[model samples]
Target: MPTQPSLTLAQDLCARLCHDLVGPLGTMAGALDLLDDDAEAAALAREAAASLRARLQVWRAACGAGTGPMTAPEMAALLEGVLGGGRVTADVTALPPGETFAPDVAQLLLVAALLGGEALPRGGVVRLAPAEGGVAVLPAGRVLAWPAALADALAGQEVEGPRQVLAPVLVRLAQAAGWAVSLSAEALTLRPM
Candidate 1:
């Protein structure tokens, strides 16, 4: 196969990452301002706080933004964040036992799921299945392309496209962890091997 141009690829990816992060952060910022200024909106404030906190935590986890390995809280917080948006619902009974993931892995998986969730604008099902080696995220019957970066990362390659900037970091994380990534847009699936 012909090699892709590196500079163009990198720039495209950066633009995508910036694009994804910008929207969520902006929404979170607005929610924070609402909480800061309102006394009567305590319930709404609480929900906003929970949702924003969860989303940001996932963002940090996927980026592995800390000094060392991530703990359970970080992984859980990221999962919670992905779930907090109230857009996608998880059917999690299919997970395996003692299926703990390193922070970076957990972060990648969680964010990938969030990406799948994004495809389901009308809110269908986002189920996480835990296998012996990793989890599988399936976004079924959704009306989106289900971010190609996720599938590429699972296949042990860097992500391609300006709309998928997070692929490199995610690919790096998967490589460092000695993991294999696979995704299918047939229904938006993520499986770790």
Candidate 2:
């Protein structure tokens, strides 16, 4: 049987989720307070709500139970929804048309995209493509930074805090899916074990 996440890891993940949600949730709250006074605030609230929904969907796919296989187009849509807006975008053109990924693989891909987004702090494109019997997540931007803590976590080092939690989570997902994680300045690739 697979090992369950430790209590600390679970708590850190919860913290990370709360951190990600707070900004948009706060925006929505503030906008709603001014909704009757300003028409623009209603639009702001809608945008914030959309961002929150997109984030929740991506998180569900990454951390929740598998929902079965997903086609490339479906995956692309989800990636676009989650990674779109702000400075980052998702490009799925390289994914083969009509191709499908098993639920575990799909989850891994979603987590990989999240990591790719992290690598691009100044806004960039996260490209997903077929790799050697697996998938490759490529992050391109003017300034690419692979966080040191994230790198350590992915290397199976002790996770320091909530900010680096996703790295270990990604490692676990790759392990469960029988994929080997490889990281480089250019891309993070998951190959068959």
The prediction achieving the highest TM-score against the true structure is: 2
lDDT of 1 by residue, 44-117 (tens): 55665666566555655565363245443444444654642465666655764345556556666665566667
Q: Write down the worst ten-residue block by lDDT for model 1.
A: 66-75
lDDT of 2 by residue, 73-96 (tens): 787677675663457888878988
Clashes of each: 6, 0
Query: All predictions: root-mean-square deviation over Cα?
Result: 5.3, 3.0
lDDT, candidate 2, residue 152?
Answer: 83
Best by lDDT: 2
Pairs that collide in candidate 2 are: none
| Reference-based lDDT, each prediction | 0.58, 0.82
